[model samples]
Target: MSGPGYRRVAVPVDGGDLAVGVWEPAGETKGTALLVHGVTSSHLAFTHLARRLPGLRLIAPDLRGRGGSHAVRGPAGMEAHARDLVAVLDAFGLESVPVVGHSMGAFVAVVLAHRAPDRVTGLVLIDGGLPLAAPAGLSAEDTVAAILGPTAARLSMRFRDVDAYLDFWHEHPAFAGRWTRELEAYFAYDLVPGDGGLRPATSYATTVDDTIDLTTGDALREALASLDTPTLMLTAPRGLLDEEPGLYEESRLATMLAGLPAVRHQRVEGVNHYTLVMSPEGADAVAPAVAGVLAGERSTA
Candidate 1:
């Protein structure tokens, strides 16, 4: 298969390089889009989304430590992620670009809009933005244990071959029945030979620290409530959470998000956390939602 309309560009951030991939539209770009991948995912996750939106120039960055990006040797958090995104925009000589973020990337987008309002024209948040409210009294270790199963396993294995790494993801609950060559290539991109075989480039430590910070974060609601940037939040009905049959749990997330004045939230009919970004279903469903937001922003501009 052909690679993404892809090219690697670097931005200086905290004395390190921010590796980003660009997908130029086939024709005129409706608008330039800057995309941020979810936790532990790379720019590859946006291939389907890029394929779907041929009218927009898309840039997908490998956040700090994932994919081809180098990890910071010092401390980092969501704020750092936002700053790196700003750096990317600056390097490209872009101003007031529309930003599309998935999962953890969405959280970063929220913070970016809140902190750097002038730099953003509009925002599209996919399957995230709500405060990661854990059940009260859940310990950091408990949350880590609960969420780190896949990370731990992914990081633990040292694969001599990429196929071994692909096999692991092929059997994962999230990818069950959703496997495709694109997905496999994405999984392959996450590995590098280490110790004896391949391991994920995203440090297990970063994943753990990020999870704790995300779940414990208290500022998202406050951030969204204060931001004036026109925003759209799209979530999946069965996001990393189990819900009662036939219930639209994502709509509940959307309802909660409705509190933000300039924010409009919606739940796509059939999608989940991972598939919400990687599959054709995800791209088809999300493109129009995002296009609608960009169109609205253009009209008002």
Candidate 2:
């Protein structure tokens, strides 16, 4: 289940088709869950989660602007992503399933729940979902750069080959000394031929479009503001590059969760935003949390 064993399917969406990966359970299926990846990341980000949750079917999709769906022509935003996700569920005949979204995917999940409430049973938002704001006077491009930093820059970089790309990621602080074969495979899948070399398959233009829409768009704020479904927001102590004070600070998270009683916040130690869903330790922590959501259990911060 750890290898690239998931069945890849192209789910048709508006403007084009979306690439989705489905991992059917080896044993009697306990349940099904839809896993959404981050901005600039593919569905392979859930490789660790697939290994941990082998009993349940895991369906993950490369967002319209990333991975196999990078060529999907359309605006990239919460509403666009939510529409694509609903189509993915429809293709699988899934009436409703618990959703686990990481980083920007979490924000998309919130939008999906808001847009089509009955389609999502519950939500597990890892390291994202709350509305994000950029410094005043920042331009659209700089806003994305300020929030994503290297993650956005890497989209335009070209590598000599897959190994070169692997080397680049190996030096990353969040991935340093923690790289696995699964991670290597995920990085390899991220590249596509470009300009006499290979560049990440994620569309830089779409990334910027989505970032600006999320940072300044009213959809996400309006969605979270009127939230009603049960949600668990997991935070990592370290930031994207293993820096201190991850995405959600306690004071800030508390203030954000004040009016939304359905959203609960919990911090996962010894992990960063990337590792929270890309590492074995992270999968262990998240797998059970998803089960709790499916079972209607109350998760406390």
Candidate 3:
């Protein structure tokens, strides 16, 4: 399927510029959605999801330290990222919109809604947002290592060419049996020419800082405590590596969600962390739920 067409916009923020991709609907827009990508991913990650929701105006931003915004110099954490998201809204003249976030971006979305509740109408957290279990006594860096595993390791490696980088991801367990043109385009956009090689556009230092905050910081915890916006959490059965027992294990997810009655949960079968937003099947499952949330918001308005 052909994805929605998007125009790139540069939104200025405190430390630097945030690159945003704006996708207008084919007809009258039912509502607006602010789509946020995962850690180490760019706005391109939302292409599949955009195609699934052609009636909604989609605004996706390449957060600081990633994609075209890799040059955005500043401290990296949930608060800074949340602030940048607000800037994105201001630049686009959007007073409030439903925010959709995937993976680490889900955590950022929660913080955004918490810090700027007036700017968010609702939230859709795909494959993330709930607290994760981390081992006790591990340093921040070590915790990141344990949580991310190979996904973290790829940030330090360099590919000789774009083809080489594509080859690397062609074997990633998450993309196994699910590669498509959309996925290819997303991956290709992540590479940039470096000294003697091609490197992912995401900054490793920024990723580490952000990862530490999402994993160990108190911001997300506090955000969940007072979460008043209508929220939906879609979880994949598998994980980043296509490993069984995805990010939020069944019992643990239940335990974590017990306190947040406002947030709804759904299990999307047959997809993993990356596919939950990057593949057609994943988009099919998510788009309808998002539409329902938008409809609910309109009814209550």
Whole-model Cα lDDT of every candidate shown, in order? 0.75, 0.88, 0.89
> How high is the lDDT of residue 182 in model 1?
82
How many steric overlaps are in each model, in order?
A: 2, 0, 0
lDDT of 1 at 132: 51
- Report the lDDT tens digits of candidate 2 across residue range 99-218: 999999999999999999999889999999997646877998899898999999898788999999999999999987788888998999999889979999999899998898888898
| Candidate 1 lDDT by residue in tens digits, 1-301 | 3333567787778857877889885556688888988878899899888877767788889988778884655555677788889899988888888889998888888888888889888889887766654556667656765654454556656877888778777767666787787898788888765888777888666766666776676546567668788888787766453232212254555566567787777777677777888898888898887677678778888
| TM-score to true structure, per model | 0.89, 0.96, 0.97
- Most lDDT-accurate candidate: 3
Note each model's CA RMSD in angstroms: 2.7, 2.6, 1.1
Q: Candidate 1, which ten residues in sequence have the lowest lDDT sum?
A: 239-248
Best by TM-score: 3
Order candidates by lDDT, high to low.
Answer: 3, 2, 1
Better model by lDDT: candidate 1 vs candidate 3: 3
Give the poorly placed runs of model 1, Cα more than 4 Å off: 1-4, 147-153, 218-221, 241-255
Model 3 sits at a Cα RMSD from the real structure of: 1.1
Give the per-residue lDDT of model 3 (tens digit) for 28-142: 8888889999889999898877888877899999999999899998898999999999999998899999999999999999999999999999999998898877787887678
Query: Which window of ten consecutive residues has the lowest lDDT sum in model 3?
Result: 1-10
Ranking by TM-score: 3, 2, 1
